[model samples]
Target: MKILHRQRHDQSSSMIFRKDYTLLIIYLSLSLVSGEFMTAGVVAVGSAISAGLLAGFNVINCMINECCTDRWVSTNYTDLKLTLDAKLYGQHLVIEPVVKHLKAHGKDNPSKALALSFHGWTGTGKNYVSRIVAEKMFAKGMKSKFVHLISATKEFPHKEMVPFYKDKLRDFIEARVKECPRSFFIFDEMDKMPPGIIDTLKPYLDFYENLGGVDYRKATFFFLSNTAGNDIAERTITTWTNNLDRETIKLKEMEEVIRLPALNNKSGLWHSELILKNLITAYVPFLPLERRHVKQCIKDGLVHKGYYKSEDEISDAKVQEIADELQYYPEGVLIFSTTGCKRIHEKIDLIMEEI
Candidate 1:
């Protein structure tokens, strides 16, 4: 009788284990389905359900909790820093201080929002860096609802559209920031924006005594343009000629150089009091990428397109040839790539077509 009872007990334990395993599989399936539903914005409680499933009982629950709990969420902590240092070929001056400021603000010490203005020639990693910042800061990156990307030229190109654009922009900023103070507002092609258009943001940008309504201080803004492209090119060329490391150059060294060109130019709105008064934070300069940097861009482009063979398939000789064929600015000076990295995809396509 005792032996029979022990066998029954062992069988019962095995059945219970199997049932738990089955339940775990069901929960995982539900989690995946819920994620898809959440992405469609159809189910309001889908995300909560998914989170509960993740936090639910499973054999690997402890491990999952240890790994996923705020690990991938914290971008300003070390993820952004790591990505900037590792992936970006140049421009430490832009990376260091920006990352520092972002990390500081992300922490509990409530400070004013960061306002960064990227000035350089087209394709010098200005847009790339902004996308990177958005990616690391939020799970969905640029796709996040909180990330408001406004293409000035595309949305508000004509003079007649200025008033409508201004009203829309103001309403968007106030509503978005009211919803989430940590929102990222990226204004691309700022050089194309008409005068007085940016000034609409002045009141929100100004420091306020009352922290009660629409505190823009907690919102980050990125203004990208080719306003100071020439100045940046000149400075980079000078550095190269003088045998100095361009990467080691600091923001203080080039901010004045970039600021003057942008502010004095008829194209940009930097002369406005909002900018001249220093309401805008750092002016990040992206230096011109040299031959080697161009080669690196080619390699990255190839890898992005699934052509990962470095030794035989994507040869250095081919990359150098492509770089040589690209037109450089200052016509024959070879100082900087005229298009920067803007046309790299086209070049890559040409090479792949040959293959």
Candidate 2:
């Protein structure tokens, strides 16, 4: 037998042990009966045949166990739609493709674990979308042990630490997938990640065999970043200024628009071929929220605060007033919310205090 690493196959030892025990039983039974009826040579040949059969059986059994174990939650498109629709608003373009890709991947003959990159301005629901996805994928949601949330700064703040971080990243992913192949790794703030670090993950993201003893195909990866936020925001503003329907925005369009900026951005991972290789399943762009979208956020905040009053009570006027209070860049043009929805709760609380 070819030996790769003893420690690596430690998890499969249980199945191997059972197979050996079964083969031994069959061999002993065959030897006992053939001893009297047949010659010693015949018995030995029979034992060899049984050993060969054991190898075949072991392969089948191992496959069965692998299939049964680490089965991810099979969520339907309708279920995902309901879960995301209730929480996310004004993201029809972002939501539709995401649900479609997820549904396709969750079913039989599933492709590589859905790798998605969320880009746009801060607080444009990138993180929120990830939370909803995690919640729907597992019973414990983000709290699930299989779900790993990594902040770039906390994990690898200094550039010098990239080498160590790369090893730890590979080990962490390998160990977790070994425990449960259906693992979700969310790497937040990819824009702040050091150069060349994202490249270390290329192998795991590629479509390949698990001959290395770790299969990442069933493992999902999400990278959240604001690297191409400016480009995204500019496109959204152009769409709005031109009175174009936002629903027409396609992933292809967004990908083409964001790719160059991300590649050029100093604080970006686009320089990594892994990103340009189209290993990422989707470049889901979270569009910059207009005043109306911000108002929707404020209304959601009110409902969360137990203020389920009429629309008049939480009037558009009041919502607009609070939105106007938010600081925006490019002084004259109100292109995007500087804080996005990050400070919506605080603004709502202040508005209530004044009332």
Candidate 3:
């Protein structure tokens, strides 16, 4: 009798395990069909009336991790703003419009792919801002399969290869958008791109519901170039000499300044139809970093490198010591860092070695 009772208990446990496993499979099926957790919840709660609460929780967890929910492509404007404020030094003009445009794009269905052209001297936070934007929008950040960063000089080197590059570029864009509607493409060193190749993106950037059945309007493209760096720098220098606050410099003042030159220059945007059609949404200007801002960068670098706990912990003398190591421009007034925070980490590494 004891042996028979033990066998019955084991059978009962096996039955319970099978029932729970079956319920989980059903929940996943419902989720996949409806693309919603609420639908799965209804089915699981109603069908698995006797299943343990642990099983229900497991179902929800799987849906969140495996499904294309808010976890994959949700935007957090607050985090973007806070990160820009904390990590990016100076460039007060950048924070507001960037957040505003991204917020607007996040909330509404844009008619065209949002295109932003970043113009500035090197290391003035253009690429830095792009990375931050990607991180805030996608769960996987820069490593996200949906985000594509391509360099013109590296990716399309020869002028004779323009035709080949154009076809490949178009095909890649189409494929990426088809796979993920909210894809991001960053074209770095836009100035180095062979002139006609960039115009290939014109169709994707224009106002269209879909190109070849793939909706490109939900995508975002960023063009990073030094095309208008000299013009932007001269404007900033004029503003400083006149004793006007850099914050007072408006986007309107810079847009026209950059627009004419970007179109006329021998770089990628030169005579490109994207410019002629006015497909680009905004021209973001990054100002050259002043001595004070470079000092801040140095201090931040020290904290980031783990040499100090915080910016406040680093002494002014030490910060100044590193700042002095970098060459500044214009000779007489020494207004801006010649490299604009580029190669800062290398400088920090060298300084630490000396110590």
- Runs of candidate 2 exceeding 4 Å displacement: 1-74, 309-313, 328-335
Model 1 regions more than 4 Å off: 1-75, 209-212, 309-313, 330-335
Model 2 whole-model lDDT (C-alpha atoms): 0.74
Model 3, 161-232: lDDT tens digits are 788888888788887788788888889998888899889999999998887788888888999999899999
lDDT of 1 by residue, 180-242 (tens): 767778888888888767877777666762345556676788889898888888888877778
For model 3, name the residue pairs that clash: none
| Higher-ranked by TM-score: 1 or 3 | 3
Off by over 4 Å in 3: 1-68
The Cα local distance difference test for each model comes to 0.71, 0.74, 0.81
Quote each prediction's TM-score: 0.75, 0.75, 0.82
Per-structure clash totals for the candidates = 1, 0, 0
In candidate 2 the C-alpha lDDT for residue 293 amounts to 73
lDDT of 2 at 115: 82
